[model samples]
Target: MRKLVVLLLLFGTIAHSQTQGFAKSSDGTPIFYRTFGSGKPILIINGGPGMNSNGFEALAKKLGEHNLTIIYDQRATGKSKLEKPSEKNISMDLMVDDIEQLRQKLGFDSWIVLGHSFGGMLASYYTSLHPEKVEKLILSSSGGIDLELLNHRDLVQKNLDKTYRDSLAYWDKKIRKGDTTYVTKLGRARALAPAYVVNPKFYAMLAKRLSQSDRALNTLVWLDMNRMHFDCSEKLKTFTKPVLILQGKRDIIPAELAERAHKVLQNSRVVLMENCSHYGWLDAENVYFSEIGNFLKP
Candidate 1:
């Protein structure tokens, strides 16, 4: 009976244990990563070129219930900070390399890759570079496979009233001028928050997450992408792995972008959630989890 009790305790501890650490990238940048559960690995890449991995912790824990869920701060964000932020240190190629380094450090020959928003673009780029390292690809409210998404005006701009737009412009100017204080960041995040979800209740939560973004890093990535003419369409066409494209019908990123990717990816499925915006989990929770859970099932 005592042995049985000990075994139960051991199992309980194992079930809840979380592993976290930093993995050195090719350029020797320490990328922070955390893992939950245990099984086939699924790396959850959160949105934002400059946002840290904190916003996805809840989502990671939920997915971790069955699969070994991994979430990491991309270089120059959260715990994965470079000694100095520069175009040379941070770029599309280097960012992709960081993901590869993390995979190697984790000892994953190949794993399921799930990326959200901007992360979708990054994941698609990563798959294009290293198709053999990806078992499956899941894009959630993705930014699409090319820079075409940038040509369209953000839904946030349309959703904002003159007052909010003015506020956003003001804060943005301040941020660009090297005034990235908490107040400045929060101001910009709040002004742009409404367009992120259909439900108003989630605005504050989304705003808080957005406020944590690193503006300088975000700029660096965008500049680098422009310099390299970042486009994954050609490479994505050659990828034969299973791909799932999940987008909210009412998202800031248009449905056409998702469709474009669907047409490009050889073996891809696209699901559009109704009454949802940029965030499907927050706006259409059931549909979001259901689609992903079903897709990831063995």
Candidate 2:
């Protein structure tokens, strides 16, 4: 049975005042969430097929200018604590259901959705399932449904240092074996950090962020997604709502994918960031947010 879990902070006076806690998912997972700003509602879905959403905190703050932004750690990630960890519990269906439930529980008629990377893929799927629930859709550096088509594993591996690449086989084995140790998780992030960012200076920042995250690399979830290879291009083709596609010119995801997405979603607008990589907001903050502001204007 699903239950709503509310955790109250008793130690710190300031922390207790914040309206943040967990919402128990159907399979009895506690999903942590926080709300920022106040206006039209907008939920920012982060990438990282299994990475925590807390890393987008600063991005959420920047987007709060005209919307009540919502950010949350997906199940088994960040502050979302799970009683029992299993790949079976990490399906895309469950993840999308969690978003719908969160929306209903929060009492929003409908709201804007901005998804980055894997989060963008999830947002697209969510729109396909429940078109009436999404006001606008923003897919940033997200690929289409076919997991194989989105495969940049080669790029990621090539970008890693020789030593890291040599150790990857060992790390992959440990991850597949369900080793949730901090070292294993942090090591994986460090190895892939180079492929995700263009700025070398941000490499340390990325490593530090991953190190601090309540990291849970659910390898099975990734494996299952690739196996199923779901595609929702047909649904997107018929989607009439406003859609925006954002991609970085230097991102490993490839700008062609975003352009293809724009073609599939007829009403979508595409924005390609110059001199930027995967993390456009980090590499070109001002331009990134400015484009978002313009696109959001009525």
Instruction: Encode model 1's per-residue lDDT on 146-227: one tens digit a residue.
Output: 9888888767787667987898999989988988789888889998888788898988998999998877788899899889
Among residues 3 or more apart in sequence or in different chains, the pairs in candidate 2 whose N, CA or C atoms overlap within 3 Å are none
Give per-residue CA lDDT, model 2, range 1-298, as digits (tens). Answer: 1232222233222332225666667777777888776677888998776678778888887687566788988887778866565767878888888898788778899999999988888899899888899989988788654464455556566555697677766777898899868898678767666767877888777876655544345565666676667777888788899998888877778667787788889789998988777888888878788888887887
Alpha carbon lDDT at 175, candidate 1: 80
Query: How displaced is residue 158 in candidate 2, in Å?
Result: 4.8
Which lDDT value does model 2 have at 84?
Answer: 68
Instruction: Name the best candidate (by TM-score).
Output: 1
Q: Give the TM-score of candidate 2.
A: 0.82
> In candidate 1, how many clashes are counted?
0
The Cα local distance difference test for each model comes to 0.90, 0.77
Q: What is the alpha-carbon lDDT for the whole of candidate 2?
A: 0.77
lDDT of 1: 0.90
True-structure RMSD, every candidate: 2.0, 7.7
